[model samples]
Each structure stands twice: as structure tokens, then as C-alpha cells.
Target: MSLSHEIMKNICGYSRAKYSTWFYYRPDHILFDAGEGVSLALRNMIYGIDHIFISHNHGDHIGGLPGLIKSRASSMGDITKPLSIYYPEKDSQILQFKEYLDVSIPKLPFVLTWKGLRPGDQISLNANRFVEAFASDHMGTLSLGYKIIEKRKRLKSEYKGLPQQELIACIKDLGREAIHEEYHKNLLVYSGDTMPLDVSIVQNAEVLLHDATFVLGSDREENTHATVEEACELAIKAQVACLALFHFSSRYSHQQVKDKIYEIITANNVEIPIHYIYPHFYPSDFKQIQIEN
Candidate 1:
């Protein structure tokens, strides 16, 4: 299978604009925005999560924390595993959620840590991969987006086109770093509850999960969330290999949502694969439709 397809199979989540929004990226054991029903949806898989990244403090985005934490403590999973949570710096709403967890689960068995982060802050997932935060334009809150970046080494510009034997000799003489340059590849990007993001933030990502809360631009009474077309446009401009739109408003029917996305894809001649979570689908039945490229 293609790398993008393999990555898609590992991700599962549910999103409804005003109700809930969350994503569980299995490969990294990272949960983005623990929304309502997260614990129930994830069930035993809750034990696999090593980190939770909160975009903002909206209740819909953080309501699942208490359940998730409590379940990990009381459920059949390993109770001593450490769990870390990262969120936008000084978000009062998230602080309130933490306080609630403290009161609700005072005697937790695990070592839970919460750290505040800024837009440029980065948390290492491993030696070569890390999660980086970036600002997002979600009104009424200090929202942020996240990028999963992988650090890779490549031959320096001057060393390109050299014969294989010559390259080996050069590598031995100059050492690896001297002949190589490091570049960051964006594996995935999640724009949590935001309007259309700046292209630069999600450029060239293998996958982009963006907010698409409105089927039509005219349906938006407020500019808090992006419309489906806007999200697709941004994905195209950013050159993302795959786009998975979530956080759709519950007002639209499944057919309406699918039709609108199809219209956008056809009208723009979008070549990259597009996927979306139908808001009406139950969490247990949650499966994104991968629109043909």
C-alpha cells in the first residue's frame, strides 16, 4: 500500500462542528483534541495514547479528558503508564478542565503531566520525529494547529550527481553531516477549529486534517470555521498529498455534505485524494469517505 493509505488506516476520529472534534493517530499514539465520547469510542485503545494535544479550551474539544483519564486509571489497561498533555499556553479554559480532572479523579494511578505550549513550541516524539505547534485563527479563543514533522538527511546540493564510489569516499572523508543536509518533512497537519489556514503552515504535508464546518460559504454567519471549498482550496495550494476534512456542522445532511465536497473537487480539478467524516455517522461507525482522486 502507498504510504498515505497506510497512514489513513491508522487514523480514526469523529468531528461535528459544535458538538465534538477529535483524532487518534495510532502510529504515534497521539490524540488531537479529546472531544466528547472519545473515551467510549477509543475504549481499550485509550491505553495506547502517549500524548494529547489540545488546540483550544472549548468544551466540545476538551469534554472527553475526564473520561479518558478516568478510564485509563480504572480500566483493564496498564494503570501506571505516563500520559502527557500539551495545549496552547495559558489557555484558561484548558486550565479549568485540568482543575475538573483534579477534583474528579484525585487519586489517579498514572503520572499525568500537562504542559503549556506556544505557537513555535515543539515536543519530541522520538529522535527524528516531533510535533510542532502553530497559531490558528479561531476566534474567541487562543487556538493552535499542529504539525507532525520528521527530520531527514539528504545529500547536500554540492554533492548531488556524484558517482556512487566517489560519494562513498566523500562520505568517509567528510563525515555524514558534512556532506548531508537535514530537512523537515511534514507528515501530517491538523487545523483544530480554525478558519482557513495559511498555506505556509501546512505546505507539502502528506496528510492534512482541516476544519470544514460549512457546506457553503453563505451558510457561515461567523468566520470561526472554514467552509468545505475553502478547506479544499487551501489543501490544493499547500500541495498536501491527502486531505481529510473534519469538524463539519451537524446541520447538513450526509448527502448534502458529500455532494458539496464532490462539487468542490470537480470544480477545482483537485488531484489529491480527499476524505471527510460525515457528521451524522455514529462514533463507533465512524469511517471517512475517501473521494477518488
Candidate 2:
């Protein structure tokens, strides 16, 4: 299967101006952000989430953490599964939120861990896969974007033209390790609530979920979220394989969002598949909207 299909197979979320934003990637058991409706929308799926990555401390971003923790402790789902949540290091809002969770849900049925991560920090998902955090430009908050990477091994370029018999001989003489090198492949990138930043950070990602909080260019505010045009420009510059725009402002109609996205793609001659999370649709329905090339 394609990397996009594997990573986004059961992904679902909702994002609108001042409402909520959350994405659940079922394949990796990873949840990005914990907005208000997460616990209710995800329900039982919450049990499968092993790691939660918080982008910032905004209420619309981390509002559902307390409910999620409490639900996991009391719900019928497997309560013993280990869960780890990573948030921006040194952010007072998240620190205060954690304290609130502690006070509200004093005891839990499973192991709950909270870690502070800086822009360059990494969390290993498994032996071959990991997630990395990068700084994002979201107003004055300490926001972050995340990249999911898969490590792969490939034969060295020098050995590409060698005959099969010669390659076998090389393996016997130099050992397999000398003939192959490991490289990292970016599977997906999630830009949680941010204005335009360096596109190079997400270069060649199989899928990029970016903030497109504004559709009308004139409605844009300073040092805030990205406009639909800006999001597409970033995706184009980064050369990402697929783009999934989210966090649209509620002022525009669903038809408006679609029309603007189509207009931008046409103007730029963009060829990659594009998808967006419409404000009026439920998250479950959002997952059904296919991305077309």
C-alpha cells in the first residue's frame, strides 16, 4: 500500500475558528492535539492511542486532555495501556493544564506520562519509526509541528550497477552492512495551528496536514494562522506528495472553501492530491472525503 494510505487510513478530525482541532491516526496509534470533542468523537478509539502530541497550549488545542484522561480511567476500554503525551517545553499553559488534570482526576488505571519536548526532540515509535518536533510560528505561543519518519535501508549507489553475482560476492567479502545505508523517509507532517514557516522542514513528505484557518486573503490577521493560498504555496514549495488543509475559519461556507482551494490549485498548476477538513461536516464524515489528484 502507498505511504499515504497507510498513515491516513482512518484519520479523522475537526477544525474551525475558535472551536476545536484534533487528528487521530489509527494506523500509528497517534493523536495530534486534544481539542474539545476528541474524547467524545474518538470514544473507544482513544484506547488505541499510545502517544498524544500537543502542538500548543491554546484552549482549542489542548482542551480535551482532561476529559480524555478521565475517560480512559473510568471507561470500559482497556485502562491499562500506557499513554504518553508530549507538549511544548516551558509553556505555562500546558503546565497549568497538567496540574488541572492532576487535581481533577487524581487516580488513573494506567500509566500516564507527560514529557516536555523542544523543537529538535524526537520520540521513538518503534525500532524503525519515530516522530520529530519542529518549532512553528503561531503568534507568540510556543507552538510546534510534528513529522513522522520511517527509517529504511537501501543498497549503496556504487553497488547499483553491479551484477547479481558480484553483489553476492560483495556481501560475502564486505558484509551486508558495508553495502547498505540507512536513510530516513518522511511519512507525514502535521502543522498544528501556525502561520507560514520554513517549508524546507517538511520537504518531500508523503502527506502534510497544514493550518488553513483563513480563506479570504483580506481577512487575515498578523502573526496568526495561514490562509488557504499560503497553505497551498507552502505545500508546493515543500514538494509534498499530498496536502490536507484544516482549521478553516467558520465565517466561510463549505462551498467557499472548496472554490478557493480549487482556484489556488489552478492558479499554481498544482498536481499533488489535495484534501481539506470542512467546518460543517462531522469528523467521521471528514474521513470519507477522498483526496483527488
Candidate 3:
């Protein structure tokens, strides 16, 4: 199924313990990373992407930039759409890659812009939605995580006790500003290749796509990727609506990964729905593979 039609569906291009990792949030036209084979896997759907956010300069995270750029320029899709790429500030590898693409594809059919992002940087998607970057623990490689926030207005606590007629009269006489408060809601959080960190960063999120590169804690490396158990704990602690785990280690079979996740959820009594992307497989629909709570 095409992910573009579903507002909550996500597209993933990842092969754990391999050379590629990426997630495409179709509703926002935002791509979390540009890992290898991303352009090929997405095909024409790539034309819809207007913003590409790179978590870090790791080869597995950014190896597909050149191909994606070239395809957008030369393919049968619209060539006039502007593409903006955001990466960590002062990332040597990304800087080098930018220079390389400049020299290799000197003349492109569309405009390509690059921005350096720092921790806590926010990029506005529209008037109501925006994306914020946060520092992630990934072997000290200057990695970052992203959160999608939406601005919303809610009725003030005092207004909740008022009758409907009173509320309508208040709105008519005092205006909405007097009875409502604007707040930001966390829609989705993507933990790009990071070890488990504070759960508060992703509290109350609608969905969380986290790194689960290892199934066993014994297999986890110091300050690197998170294991399945860690991802589950964070999701449960944060009370997220759903957790989608990706970046599984290639050493484990699909059955092994599923078994471990079930074991963890059962042991901890986690109530949130948990989903996983099988290693080496490209899932067309994200919701189909969710494991029962």
C-alpha cells in the first residue's frame, strides 16, 4: 500500500547491522534520514519529499544523498520542487559529501539547499506543526533525535465547569482567547540510532520510532544503540500511543526478534502497542506488522 494516503503510516528503509537506515513520514513530506537504497526503494514517491533530515554523518545514515539528488533531477517526476537537507552542524562527513555533490552534479534541474542544525533547533513545517531536534547518545558522534509538534487550542480549566449557553455567551462576548489556551502536542518522536536516554523527551507522544539494534543486553555496546528491552521501557515510561522499533541487528532472525520483544512486553506488562520492522525487508504498510500488546 502507498503510504501517502495514510496520515499516520510511515515508510522505512533500514537493514540493521548494515549500511542503511531511514524513515519517511509521508504526511509531512519529511524524510528522517537518507540511507542507501532509499531513492530506489521509494521510487516516484521520493518526489513528494520536500525536507530531508539527517540524524548524523554516519555512512549508513547518509550514503544515499547523491543518488536521491540525481534521481530527483533527472527522473520523470517534477523537477522544480525545492529540496532542503538538514544535518548536524560541523559534521565533517556531511560537509565533504555536500562538496562532492556540488562538484559531481554541478547543474541540477531543481534547487537543493543545505542547513546545519544544532541540538534544540526547531524547523517550522507550517503554521501549526514543527520539528525539533534533540541530542541523542550515539557513541559521541553528534547524533540527534527529532520530535514532531503540533500547536493546538484547548478549553481552559475554568471553562469546563461552565454551561454550554454560558460558554457560547462567553465566547461571543469575551472572544476565544479568554476561554482557551494554546498548547503544543508531541505527535511523533524518532530516536535515530541512539542508546536509551530520558523518557521525558518523548512523553505523551502519539507514536515513537526508536532504535532497537540489539535484542540482548549482553550484545549492546557501550553508549551505542539500544536493545529491544530498552526501547520497550522507554515507550512504557513515556506512555506513548504506539512504539515502532527498527534497526534490528542482522545477527538475529525475525523469529528471534519477535520472541524477544514478546518476552520483554510480557515480563514488563507493557500496554502500548509495539511494532517492528524486520531486518532486510521493506514493509509497504507499517501498521500491518504491529505485535499485539
Q: For candidate 3, write residues 1-293 as lDDT tens digits.
A: 32212335555455555678888887789999888888998999889999999999888889889899999998989988999999988898889999999999888888899999998899999999999999999988988889889999999998898889999999999998988999988888888989985888999888888998989899765868999888898989888887888888899988888889888877887767777787657634343233453
RMSD of each: 1.6, 1.9, 2.7
Candidate with better lDDT, 1 vs 3: 1
How well does candidate 2 score on lDDT at residue 268?
78
Kindly report which residue stretches of model 1 are placed more than 4 angstroms away from their true locations once superposed: 284-293
- Against the true structure, what is each candidate's TM-score? 0.96, 0.95, 0.93
> Model 2: C-alpha RMSD to truth?
1.9
The total number of steric clashes, by the backbone 3 Å criterion, in model 2 comes to 0
Per-model C-alpha lDDT, please? 0.89, 0.87, 0.84
lDDT per residue as tens, model 2, 1-293: 87775556667788866888999887788999999988999889899999999999989988888899989998988999999999999998899889888888987879999999999899999999999999999888899999899999999999998999999999999999999999998898999999875878888899988998999879985869999888899889989888888999889988888888888877778888788888778874553233356
Clashes of 3: 0
Give residue 270's error in model 2 in angstroms.
1.7
Score residue 256 of candidate 1 by CA lDDT. 88
